[model samples]
Target: MESDLRIAGTNSRPDIVAWAASEDGKVVPWVVIEIKSGASSSKPEFVLPQVAQYASTLGTADNYVVMGTKWFKADRSFRRLEPVSGPTPPPFGSHGEVDDPAVVEPLLTNWLASLTREMAPRELPVGLPTLEGFSVTNEAYWRAAMRAIADTTSRSGFAQHSSSPLIAALVARLIGNRLEGLVLDPFSGVGSFLWAVADRVRGAMERGESPPNVRLLGVELEERTAAIARAIGEIAGVPTDIVAGDAFRVELPMSSAIVTAPPVGMRLPQPYELLNGRVTTDMDLAAVDLSLRHLEEGGRAVILLPRSFVYRSSGDAYREYLANEFRVGALIGTPRGAVPGTSFAGVVLVIDKGDAPGETFVGQAADDDWQVQLGVEGALTKAAVDHLDGFSEIWS
Candidate 1:
């Protein structure tokens, strides 16, 4: 939805654009949304009238929200609710608005947490609460926790790593739905994938379903990255067996699913192997082969590859390797700038181990917003493909 609004250029428009939802299995009301910069100083006087006009034009009382840095300053005209504290009294005559990002962020966070709790059961191997009470107050703590994991990996010796909240959310959705019980990230960079996967496992426990013993078995060549991955799992309460070794050579425990985000080979040291007493090849094929080996006979895998790996003239070997190993489930065409700090467009190549009767190709809209593209849309696409391909058949 954020992607649609960003690309369609209709965030501030009056019409409600109805579309399929990617967040949860539900339809969302697409009303006008105004993103203001400063909510601390301005009263809702000028903005409320404009929003009211827009809502009237659409003939819907749907939310006309303004996201900015401010607190709730209540006026008699509009009703406002603060996070924990009681309803703030109307300001003087009629100054009603929400102030303070600190106050608002936690309020929104709790609301979202509540929504998730309502949707699923609350139990886990650890029974730790989600980032609700203290975590809400200390946003930096959660971030620091994630950073600690990253720093652990970096200092340990792993040079390549990525931190992504989007991946975490996707893992959460998958675990919540019980669509997958395990996650194997063969190219687990700096343990970001481990942290995200663990976070999802925790979320599954919170959502009623007995959180599956979701083991995150990752293989990292860089020792530092392996250490970081281990530290993140410890902190997040997710069991991770992150081994420091070549992803191609390391052995993986049996699992029902795999989610890997491999290096795009944009800028990385080339791998070398002594074959017949001489080093040969760039080693790209070796990584793909490793991904295939970890997948079980009927399991599904989501592997990230450079778009060139699909159609490049020189990619015949890699393509053939894929064709010979796993069943081609779907090829999602990622858009330009889909991944941050990288120039190339990504492709989420979904694969199922062993041959299948038939396959389908889905072309989805590339989420234009960088945050939504990386966090929401990319994960959503993978989950959708998993759903369409039938998780039951893969795991059963």
Candidate 2:
């Protein structure tokens, strides 16, 4: 139940701060836990440095770092760090391991639970209304739940879907700092894009810097989905307006930056005005066109579209329109199944409204390592920018 414990008299917040009770009923710090997400660096060598730093601050040699199913001890004797897999008890060599099996099991369980809660909030903040009455308050959990719902709904061929969290974060980083005024996600789905924006702002604040001035606007056609998006925005403490309506028909202000993964292969009831009333069936084009219409001059858009939208013969007009009207900044190809439970390989298209580029940068992501590829420090580096393709154009 020490999930909410904070390090006393210090700004540093370790992932989990375990405590043990003494004979006099005085509580004492037992272990410092640092949990890394699956997307993060799980290798002991990569994480132990930071764990060592935290241990130094806590003045405890009983420090541990948990990454996915792996755990490592941070101490002078920290050598040959190997991750212990499965839900079973920690091995004997684990840092701060207790002698009794009964005593250690509950401690490890509580620590894991604490890690989960830290990563995703356990309880929903009071007074927020949700579409589904489910009480799970974790952002990552809800995103997966929404994706599963989309999979079931996709059976009817009504919804396409949003990007996975990894993809969404990558798209947001590609749009980095260019986001100004209102940020729009026309097909918000479960608000992955919006949450990415909030996470960026939150990350900046956490680093003791001023958060960028940006507002989020998400339009989801389904009311239930919109409610979930709204709840996510609230939980993340981001100012967002989630509208339940068709994005094509919804009246919205022009945005400085737009980021979204619009549903593909869906037919719209009516063609968007931005498409000049010529194309109505292709939702992908409609999405691109809608983003173009709402995006202000000098503003930018980072959109996720099916790879066919770029090279397929049927999408020639869309490609031509994109080339003529917008400057192609970068096109990043993602591996198949990056979205999970789907075979739709995708491309991240960075479009600028002012001038069309003579040459566009194109690259394919080798894997879904967003933590390093999209990390605040890691993603913004010159080499990372160049690796993203179109670094010269984007920075120039």
Candidate 3:
């Protein structure tokens, strides 16, 4: 503990530094915790941006800051945040934090600064493809690492970040029982949607039921991230194939269901035919188009996109075409800040390729806690799924 660190070009000492052993037996600092007076402006809760920098400098997996009874934490990230994003402080008593100051508090008072806590330490998770014997399939660790990467990399109000498993769960449900044949994620960032699908199928299996036999395919632009996603699937006993390439350029199959949260707000430089024989510069619209293009006749697509996509002027023609030729099953709104790196509201858009647009299910989120809107038992999601379940009766 009390290790010297070169944070912000200043020589600072952390109150406690937990160390862990790597696969090759290299001991490294695994966590950093700082104790600050609650009355001080520099309390741990107010300096997340700085703590993120600390984690980056010390190469720690998780960083903690304690002020009296309140605790704040930040995960590790190699990238640095830019100006304009400003620092959004973490809340006291964040859910699922991996630190306790009580142990350290006693040590601090007794001046036992060099002592390690009695609890067994977890192996160092040095990120994708680097840390041996570390698994990213653990949702808690996976979520922290993903959030670390997203927070440091995205510096604007409109940036594309990986969707949380919670958001993935919301989108995965719209795929319904279409698990037969190919299940695809065209813009799978770290494969949250794919994992959620696997979780759903596994849940059914646990209940001694047979879900549709399916193949999971994810197309990701980043190779390293894709590799991690693949690893997660392999470790979870779900054989997912993640392609390290662009979904738009890759050869795709006729998919039974497409579940994804594509990068938000990227515009095509030139008009692209991402839709059925149609061209548009809006990538959001184009992504949906590409999904629909590869979607089989009876397939469904569940996509999470910016709420503006629903009413954007550029999507007018595409929406019109969908209304006439395809089924727009549901549009459920998510509250602002539901997804990190994005500061605006999001819409869960569902498309059924084989059916005509019937009485569509439209629902708005009630709060920032997305579960209220998109959980398995989410009120809006339940209502919409129920509508999709019986919408065919409209024509009967």
Candidate 4:
């Protein structure tokens, strides 16, 4: 059995490709499986046809479509294709439903055999080393590959690649060089910040240095996106716990540091119940506020917020609260269009559990120059470090 197997010379990659063994131990295509998530459009009428179309290319009728947990086989006995129920289990884990080995084992075995036969004559490209091995050995290559994947999959408004690798590295650096205990990301999309920290820690270890033992924790609202982050972490050999649930409602462990880029312009369905009867409609600010609660005293938090957050009238109360509760270490203005989808410029707000500063350091970068200043090497420049360190005495 193969999952997310890309069809040869075709853009359509089926969710699962199964094979069966012949009498002489030859593998042959057994079935093509297309699975739709519970939140996706997986109606029988719609998916059956799509699966059939994919199967037609393989010159086989053994195609199966699974929507959520319901599985259906396409029946072409009549003029129009009809869907018939099969012994296959419904979406795996729906309502804690377990797969019947008596029904599913044979199906999977046959599929695997078929796939083995189909690949017998093909010479595939050399696959890259596993993410864990490659990342530990080659930091540059791993960072590049991660950035490429992030850029390719990022969607404009729904899910954007907001944090740059440089920015992530800088945030991790500010949090601390040796981060022991838990590092939490309230809005970890693809685990960029987690990955950055992992790379840094692993690099130190590789240099014959003793880095603090750090555990990564992330909470994402979307299950599919959470799965992606988990997959990336697994490949990179980073021990990560990514929970697929509402961050506002989830119970979080006390963290040594927090770094995240909360979604922008999103309104909460209801007021979040924070400590001391505090509630707010702004999800972005609420995310930051919630993160603060989880941080241990003296713990650092690096967050990305819209530039308007500094001056918007609606944010006055929140800003005042931030001023009173957390030390405003620095506010680095990011170039416009820094984030892929939106024109809303952003600022990196660094906070620590300490005495509030009399003023916040404010710095700006030009659009064209920002690319150079925010790269891996650029992040370590004296100017860049100073901006993040609140070295400048400028007041906000």
Q: Largest lDDT belongs to which candidate?
A: 3
Ranked by TM-score, top first: 3, 4, 2, 1
Off by over 4 Å in 4: 1-147, 153-162, 273-278, 355-358, 379-381, 384-396
Kindly list the per-residue Cα lDDT of model 3 for residues 1-396, writing each as its tens digit: 465344667666567766554444444556677667746734344566666666776676667766665565554342322222222332321222223222123322222111111231333221233223322234433344334333333333213425755677777776765567788999886677787787777667666777667679999886655755665566444567888898878998889899988787687777897445667778888888889989999889999989998898868788888888898988888888787676889888889998867867888887765666677776676677678774221110
Task: Name the Cα RMSD for model 3.
Answer: 14.1
Which ranges in model 1 have alpha carbons more than 4 Å from their true place? 1-159, 167-182, 266-283, 317-321, 355-357, 370-383, 390-396
The estimated TM-scores of all candidates read: 0.53, 0.59, 0.62, 0.59
lDDT of 4: 0.62
Which candidate leads in TM-score?
3
What CA RMSD would you report for each candidate? 12.8, 12.6, 14.1, 15.7
Error of 2 at 14 (Å): 21
lDDT per residue for candidate 2 within 92-184, as digits (tens), equals 322331222222233323332332232435353323322231223244333433333333332322234445656666777777547667899
The alpha-carbon deviation from the true structure for residue 91 of candidate 2, after best TM-score superposition, in angstroms, is 28
Question: lDDT of each model, Cα atoms only?
Answer: 0.48, 0.62, 0.65, 0.62
lDDT of 1 at 182: 61
Q: By TM-score, is 1 or 3 better?
A: 3
The C-alpha local distance difference test score for the whole of candidate 2 amounts to 0.62
- Stretch of 10 with least lDDT, candidate 3: 108-117
Q: Write the per-residue lDDT of candidate 1 for residues 1-396, one digit (tens) a residue.
A: 231222233455532222222233222232444445565325544455545555454332233344354333223243541222222322232212222122233333333233233233333122212332222222333355554333333221222365344543443333223335567777776566566666655555656656566667777765554654554455566666777787655567766677767765733255544222233344444455555666667667666666776777655655665666557666665665544446667666666676553454554445565345334345544455465545422211
